[model samples]
Target: MKKPQRSTAIFLLILSALLLVAMATFFYLKTQRQSAKTSPTKPALTVSTAALEQSLLPQRLSANGAIWPWQEAVIGSEAGGLRLTEVRVNVGDQVRKGQILATFAIESVQAEVAQAQASLAEAQANALDAAGNAEKARSLQRSGALSEQQINQFQTAEKTASARMLSARAMLEVQQVKLKQTRLLAPDDGVISARNATLGAVVGAGSELFRMIRGGRLEWRAEVTSSELSRIKTGMSVNLLAANGLPIKGKVRMIAPTVDPQTRLALVYVDLPLQAGAPNDPAAIRAGMFASGEFEMGKTMGLTAAQQSVLVRDGFSYVYTLGEDGHARQLKVQTGRRFGERIEIREGLAPGAVLVTSGAGFLNDGDLVRVVNPPMPPTASTAANPVPTKPQP
Candidate 1:
């Protein structure tokens, strides 16, 4: 009975200590909850807000290809078995139509012309004598100064001599043409792209002597998929970058009717401006150079936002919009054509919604953001009168 009384006293003391501790802990938790509710949450970032606005954006199609000549004209020799005497032009030389490109040693050809002329003169002298003889024979026919057979013989001789003279004249004309062929003349206005003629080199007839780009024109052969080819039309405006990064302006000249079998891509021929292909122009481009270009297909209206407002994450585009609760809500969006500093929002966005224009990449979902106005640009007057600085020691 004494041990049971001692144990009950100890249990009562422990229960009283536990009750006192539980009351103090409950009051401490109440104080902490009240303090947490009254504290201000710090913002994750400060950003500017912008709303989607309707703007006219250009519709464009991009393709990559190589620069080429609008039409390459091969210049070959017409004279056969002649030695090339002189080369008047080199590659990259600009030439005009009817300009003399090269000249051959004309001594031999001129001698042939002289020989033909002499032969023609002799034939003419013989023909004149034959005509006099025929007339004399016909006049003496009735007087019996010549027999009928003799008169016929004289007339036949006159006809034969006349035929020989006519043949000689034709030979002279042929020789004159060969003489003119000795001087190779340019057939069109162009820039020389190649030259095969060598001084003192014997070249065969119809052999290539030079190659030229007709009209001094250059074209961009844009390679486009079969699907993209359908949207292109003649006279469409094109902007291109040369291999050297020179900007070129052009117009669509034509589209190839057939697609390449291996690549299945069609060719779009764009006629570049004359200045862009002239040899003397500093911005001139060359053939066989890879380039990129875009065809302008006019403009259409679209909802655009500042390009910075959109961000790409995991290969998908996203934008942050401010909510009434003062936190960022990350929303996925579909993007399209891009203009100067704005981008087209194709889908997944509603008009008139405000978006974080800058510092969006630093924020995450449910991040508190402080909306602020974008800083204004410096005026010309302020830029001209910059702040003066003191010399450093």
Candidate 2:
């Protein structure tokens, strides 16, 4: 019985071994079938590329700034008295140089002028009479027909009358000039900025009445940081935007010699030209309207790319370049200055080299890419399939 049991155990062990082998074969076949069914299929990636070319770029710094008129002139009263009349020009109205803006009621001044004119006329007639009298007195004295004392008295009286006539004429001229000052005139061609005086209000001499921006052109006082200020110079190209969405082109007219101590900003004055083919009018731009500007310091010699074409991965910048064998070769790059839409490549790039302009982020090193509309097929080979390494026995 013990011998039969041992033989039975051995037979069972052999059957178990056969079953394990069959199970192993089934699993291996199943794995192979699944792998065949789900093999990775590579889809062709279409991309666009750009050729690198040497061009001018600018080193720019951005900062907040304000706008001011190119030629701001404060309108002030030159003569004291009451404001009697306001003219057609007010805030936002166009005015020409020497245009009457306002007037002060000077009834008293007018009366004084008339009085001085009358005094001048009377003095003129008296002076004529005095000349005749002096001539007659001198002739009488020469002929010995009148006493010397009498002739001398007549001569002194004539001289006194002539002096009075001259004084009266001087007074009349003074009154006329004063009367003209009562009418406020526009000092320059400009738009009225403010109207501080009203009819029936008294104003003192040198009092500020209205502010005007001289000339029809506008300007912007752009504030730039100390570092940025150094990069800019007079005559740099600039673009100006107004609060009302008006875009104007300009250039730097001047740069402040010293920066503001508190703000650490320097003022760059930009002169905005009138729109081409636009009619010139006095009411062009108002003073103190808010404006912003972009100044092109100049062309900076650096590699540049469109802002969308750059890629960032793992805290490093990268760009896809077409290698010699028609594949996307990823390269680490360093970038510098940025203009509106173009960025400068500071390092890791060469001029006149073609690179992937878009879709650089969706690529790996040595990726196989179909260049859409390329000039010619690249000479570089695509990446090869990675082989799996066998485990140690």
Candidate 3:
């Protein structure tokens, strides 16, 4: 019985030793599997990078604006009559100062002028006869051939006839002058912006018949908010972008002294330059068209970057600065006016600071990033010969 029990104990010890070896192997395999799963298989992604550049950016302001004329004139008829003649001028027609535009039928006016001349001649004759009668009466009275009462009566009759003829003559002259106003003439050298009078149309006195923009000097009336008033001034340079995307040069002519009570906006006037080749081209710029004006406050000192460098979500403008731990950090920044391809950064970034210029749209705040080409400091030699340095360097 003692031999059997010893054998059983030896078997149990061997079994315990085998179980320990198996447990150690399983743990080693588990550790190997975990390490393999944690390791990344793909190569790191690289992105193109550029060094922060220092340059002078413009301090400017942009506002919603529109085009307007320097002075607008509404042409109308001076006298009321049926339109009989339109002498060549129409919409978009360039006219000189005092050039006849249209005419009304006033056939009776010609007759009235002739009648006035005849009446004037008759008045002259009557005045001569009255003077002669008065002289004769005086002579007769001096010779005692006429009584004082009779002489006075003759003098009064002659004076009454002379006054009647003078009154008739004056009435005739007024009628003749009114006839000359039948013709419509251009008040100044300008283009006819609109026309309301047509052939055979009757227009009343002081009725609008044509609208002309005087001198062809067009201007833009831009609406600006009260807060943006100080950023603009008279004679400051501006660039106007039309709806058609054409750029035209202009200068601020006036700033509104008072703000509109309702809209809190001021109308800023800017004079647009005439096209050198064709100053009178009507199709060049039409009034009442919407436009945008860029007020360039000149170049600013400090950092300026491409518009894509800014991340705008909701109302805040921000940028992503890559952290040392390969994570992106969000930074709020103040922005200034926008140029064609770039915008001015007012705050939140310093020179030599690195940022994500592109691919920011795909990144989230604090996301890990693999900078393809890291930003490098400019070596003394590289700074001296920047043109020869490799693009990525």
Best by lDDT: 1
Candidate no. 1 TM-score? 0.88
- Position 11, candidate 3: lDDT: 100
Candidate 1: tens digits of C-alpha lDDT, residues 262-317: 99999999988888877876766888889999999999999999999999999999
**Cα-based TM-score, every candidate:** 0.88, 0.73, 0.72
On the 0 to 100 scale, the lDDT of residue 215 in model 3 is 79
Which stretch of 10 consecutive residues in model 2 shows the poorest summed lDDT? 275-284
- Pairs that collide in candidate 3 are 46-372, 47-372, 57-300
lDDT of 2 by residue, 14-89 (tens): 9999999999999999999999889843534878888665557764444445556566788888777656566556
lDDT of every model, 2 decimals: 0.92, 0.76, 0.78
Ranking by TM-score: 1, 2, 3
Model 3 residue 203 CA deviation (Å) reads 3.9
